[model samples]
Target: MPITRWIRGAKLSFARLPIRGGAPSEPAYIYRDPWKGDAEQGARIVSGRFLFERQEYSFPSGRWDQGTWPEPAQEWLHSFCWLRDLRALGSDEARLTARALVSHWLSYPPTDLLVKNASVTGARLAAWIANHEFALASADRRIQQKFMERLLQEGRTIAAFLPLPAQGWKGLKALKGLLAVALAIPEQTGFMSRFLRYLPAEIERLILADGMVAERSPEAQFQAARELTEMSIMFRTAHSSVPPILETSLDKVCPVLRAMRHGDGALAVFNGSRELYSSVIDEVLAQGARQKLLAPSMSQGLFTRLALGKALLIMDNGPPAAEGFDKRAHAGTLSFEFSYQRHRLFVNCGSAEVGAWNKALRASPAHTVLVADGLSSSDFNAEGRVVRRPAHVMCEHQTDGTAHWLETSHDGYYPPLGLKWTRNLYLGGEGEDLRGQEIVEGERATPFALRFHIHPDVTVIRDDEDIILKVGGMVWRFRQKGGQINLENDIYVARGRVEKTQQIVVESIQYKISSEDNKLQESDEASSKDSLSENKEKKKFSQTVTWLLERIPE
Candidate 1:
């Protein structure tokens, strides 16, 4: 290690020695975890099978952190949120199991750099503080003091770090932990005041003006809400007023997150988001302020919502998030999801927590959008920052209270294939009709494919040129004029695991825009010759594919 690194490490180690400054040993509050955990997970943990981040490990008793393990599973173990699962089991044996694991962890504290990661440490500290009753209330006095001392040390460490970079939502988790410590133990006057000092600017930098996260993810939005809600609960537990700025930030975010949900109560799978349990989402929403639904059509946050009767749709209309926040961003520009009532019909394959699945799902092919020559509309470099994304995305939304329609265009393919992509979507017929038109304007014949990923719960069948989907009592048809349609095997990973599903892919059709196609329409002919709009319209030559979804009268 360099001298600087050694000195920094020495300072951090010195900082951990028995938190002093004459504060009381006991905390003022121990708040319960607001979210529930899986009883199945609790059983698996007790059985010595550790399942996390889509990887499973079977270890002998009490040696979870000792053996060779997947990196993510190790992080999960050290972060210590698994206590929720044991607490959910709600048995004396379960509590003792937790106590044993926690006690061993506190004593031996894993000696890896990842274990000391600020976010990991923050989360572990918060978990230890929040669930002390179940984890160690009856443990020996020395063990209890050691736990508090660790909490105090980690609390001050992250409080000093303040805003973390490249950690979008995970950074908030760290802050959530810091806030938990500050409020739970009133004696750490410095920790409480320091937390209040740096909060507003951090929230402003992370959250955008319109309530969406800077990362442009529905999952991030939901997680950020959970963090803020816990902080609010912490304030209430401490008998202090929730900071006005904190409440304001929460209010801005909840409505936008609520509007992103499909007809199903969970969030729509966009960016790095997945379908979190709807019950938990409802629980999170119920605790804070009432979130009024956003407008059926909007440009802010660039995710448009349209609903008529039971049919609802969310479309991504913006480019990938600007650089620093684009780590979890996807390249599915102009893709949309559709659902009816509580059932999803079309979706983008949802994202995962980690591993190859997440990387594979980030490309444009995993979404319901057009791909030119199998290239992503946006792609990440080795560092995972977005590069080669659509340069200027234009979306025009229109509605008349009874119908919703939008026109979107992007230059994502223009640079590589000399083609520009435009899509038009219309929803009408009291939630029964959905029409889409895909137009590509290019110099020569270009091959492209359009994909629509169907939900695993929806059954699909092909009948000649028309396609059919059935879920519950509702039946819908998909018909297109583009090219051959094939139903291929796929998988849905957004519900936090993988399940067999299928996708409808319209194979590459060679399309060319001819001179006649660029001729002026009669409406343009009537306009004055000096009109700039007329000249622009004359250059718009394109090959178009139109499709529709309508209910087959049951």
Candidate 2:
């Protein structure tokens, strides 16, 4: 929030650093012209013209007192605008900005640092390292020295920054990679080599077995990937191969990355990040392509090309990855993300915007499941407290050509109510229709709940036989034999400004079971007795409803 305020009022500009003029250089193999134009064209415009243009600063100074200057505000304003301007102008201007920015950044001492400020600084420094092959190859020695020194200072700050033990793993990995690059810099070899030795253990602890980062949010995963990819590029440019673990880690991660993408080029924004960066995925994919690594196909819109060579299926078998140092992971477990033929299905609820009011909005019901009792998993509370350990069990899953089946029997939810829920999902083989069943296996009959956060354009209708969902004129029906309820007409869950009212509906039905009797008269009595028992059971747990849903159509 403070950073957001700082960004609004800052004066930032970039001037293109001179490139030794010659025959125009051939574009690098990995380089694709950005949407606006090649980086150079944009750079020239910003450096020669835009830098002189004045603009109003909406960012706050956070300087309540007159004596002390808002150092963080200044650093953020310059760094944020510098990065934006670099992208607009080209790597030449970016290099120039990086050089000047680093020099200014290093002039300050480490004790006066802000965590977010350091994080962004690391990202920009890493970006410079990535583009070094093209932009910095013929740079001035003074600029290079200043760049290296600034990067080292960032590394030290990151290393010293107190990160929460559980979630800081990804940030730590990123910090380590950045530091490794700084160490590889000619002047910082001794210090960096010693720093680099500790990275392997750190990476092993942070990265999960399935290539998912410790913090499971797609946004965090993407950010970590961007940072890692940049570091790897820098290492390769320095003539050093990447660490073997990173190479192996990325292989497992690519599918999940692919799975998290929607049919649109945008990622399924979940957790706390919704601001789409310019060509973030494109840069990563370009790097991956040049390295001969298989990357996901991504497009910007409905009719854009959908890369299908890489198909992925992701299941949330555990609670959100531990939020060690990062606060972006969500609380949804037993959920899934699937991508095939350029179509994505069943994504985590996209992220909320960052700031104060948006804090509770992050826990919006539409973003996740709100069972009749509580959350789907008990690993963490809304305040992010780890109340219970995640249950360990074999989650049986099988996928055939037509449908996928998932069965999770975990004790994680049993402690609160002596209840065990085995959730089974049958997704149509073609990935169109889905049917789910939650069997409560416990001494007492408990309420079973399922919530669906529909996309904005979706339309929902509750019918006697089924619940029908219409998206873009396509109708999909979910049929239930017993009875149906519409909770949207009943409950109110706090969704943000996007929807005036978030609708949630609940439905229930009853079934009758009877057996043939030896005689007709005896059969009548047996039926009556069975009816009495059923009535008593229903009365005992009248609150146990069958259906609860929160939906948004595509």
Could you say which candidate leads in TM-score?
A: 1
Every candidate's CA RMSD: 5.3, 11.0
lDDT of 1 at 137: 80
* Local accuracy of candidate 1 as per-residue lDDT tens digits, 294-365: 633335568888889889988999998887788889998999999999999999998865677867899999
Off by over 4 Å in 1: 1-14, 17-24, 58-71, 291-298, 516-541
Error of 2 at 277 (Å): 8.3
For all predicted structures, in order, the TM-scores are 0.90, 0.63
- C-alpha RMSD of candidate 1: 5.3
Give the C-alpha miss distance for residue 248 in model 2, angstroms.
3.2
What is the lDDT of every predicted structure here? 0.79, 0.45
